[model samples]
Target: MQVMKFDMCYICLACFCIYVSGCERSNNRQIAGEVEGERIYLDEVDGMITNSLYEYLFAISETRIIAANELINLKVLKIEAGSRRISVDSLLSMEMRRISMQETKLKYIRDNALQGGVVDERNPFKLHPLDTPAGAEILNNSYQKFLRIRLVDELRVKYRARILLSRPQPPQVDLTNVTSHARGNLKALHSVTIVSDFDCPVCREAYPELSKLFERYSDHVRFEAISLSSSVTPPILFAECAAKQQKFWEVYGYLYGQKGYDFNIDSLIAQFELNREECKSCLESRDQHKIIETDMNRLRQVGIEVTPTVLIDHRVYHGPLTDKAIGRFLDDLFKETPNPGN
Candidate 1:
């Protein structure tokens, strides 16, 4: 797994929300961008444009940084027959700024616990204990109030820098173009939607059952897997690339077909009959990268938090996507209304 230089801002947001609200909530919002870059090539696999993590990072750098320094690397992509250029520092800075804002918000709420009677609107901090008057008396101490105010002020300044730095520059355009090939596939399906990550154990485990389910109901199912790699690589977009080659089902079969399997890039890429050059090129292309970000933004809009999150019959499933569970849910739905689809 490639260790990302930037702190995972999502984790920071989670911590901040938990501290402030005393409730478990997540903050994984998607920011969008428009591309004014050169006309590029994209591989159409399995009726969809292929995307990958490598591509997304590239796109972000292009939009964020005016110039790519020596630290930035440019590599030729085989799939699109294009060069992918990116700045490491710029990407790291973007992620860090995101984390900083979250941390600052958490600190602000903590600081204004109850000093001077001005409390934070989202107070997660506890007031003085009240088992007896002595505990309540301690709350009246001026020293404690002073300490809290000082702490809040200091932390706020630190986090404000982060918020400013990570703030997303305006997106030039929103990338949500579904290729003609992809549209055709959608028309064939009773429903077209994105599934959860490949790295998720549940996703791996659910692979065979999902394949079987899709096969049995091919007349009504159009399934697209969202590649949520625990690693930095964009596994989902790679899967999309395979789909363009009309190999999505085949690749999906090979991937989910194996039980308790661990998939790596080399192993998975080797299995494809795709034009290695084009697949590689598209996987690293700037446009494809932007598309993946758009997809992620769409997923976030629908409030997806975990992998193996499925949208069957327009209903979102966040829990385990098991055979019995799904079957029971589907069966019950059909039972309640014999013609739910209609």
Candidate 2:
């Protein structure tokens, strides 16, 4: 049995938003090169490589978050161990004995087996699994890893330790080609961008939660969906055609509401009151497919390769797509704090 791991990185942006950049913006505005007797500033070159810059900033922030947690835990460990007149290793050993992980894992396995489910011998059941199947001998190493994590969490609470690092600021996405499909407050400071394909199953499953996000933040947050189909899916282009009539969101909802991937063009026309001849012409010409190409090109420039990549406020968000997770993100984004450090 292995103990549960603790996440010292809460990734709480609200707690980490206290960054006060001392660097001058005038540096970026400094003239770099002259083109045809015209002076060129760094902003043009900066714009071209904003993706790499975002990645660099993200790396720095993530490293700071992780290293701060590690240092805080070490300090707390030393303090607690010193109070008890024991070495840090001895303190960890004592704490590890108190965790009921063995009983928990056995119960979990027993419950799954009793329910006639095929429990994977390789995953959570396996203690510190190697490349091969899990065995009992290697379990001690896995237990030790989890023990330290749990101990760190306990010490953090005892010491009221906090990590102080600001979250990275991502560059703004180019929204010119995608404005037609956008819904919500156009002037709102906060925005959500989803790169998705209509036929992708994961995209289909995500719409419900996305719908909730739209509804929940309808007042302040705008949602702009960009198609991710490399080639044309008729339904996807059809939605774009619908955008001309200001029915993109309606078509978007109708497409995702279906239980299966296959869509009927005539049914869509009938339901949405679109002109049959024009809709057919639009579908045949594939003119709207260019929107997808534009989306693809823009996403590539930003280093996104997967379907359903969600960017909130132009920052790539990699978190669970649940209401609670989104709520925490929103809270982090909108709430004020004395110091932004997590």
> How many residue pairs clash in each candidate at the backbone level?
28, 6
> Model 1, poorest ten-residue lDDT window?
70-79
Candidate number of the best TM-score: 2
- Tens-digit lDDT track of model 1 for 1-342: 112423353345435434433321325322223358533222112112112231343244433332331112121111112222335344334434555565453363366463323312245353444344643455434333444344434444543411111212211222134321222235342342445565567777777776565555455444545544333345567777777678776766666656645656566677675788788887878887776666666655444445665554444543235665555444444444444353
For model 2, residues 1-342, the per-residue Cα lDDT tens digits are 111112323233223332212112444455669979999765665556655555555555555566787889899999999999999989988877676454354553464343232323356452332333433333434445656787788889999887556666675655565433678877677777888888889998988888888888777777788787667677778887777777788888878877774578888888899888877777776445665667677777666767887888777775666655666566667654311221
lDDT for position 109 in model 2: 42
The lDDT of model 2 is 0.67
Estimate every model's Cα lDDT from 0 to 1. Answer: 0.46, 0.67
Candidate no. 2 TM-score? 0.54
Cα-based TM-score, every candidate: 0.40, 0.54
Off by over 4 Å in 2: 1-40, 101-103, 107-133, 137-140, 174-192, 198-225, 229-232, 238-309, 316-342
Reference-based lDDT, residue 272, model 1? 73
Best by lDDT: 2
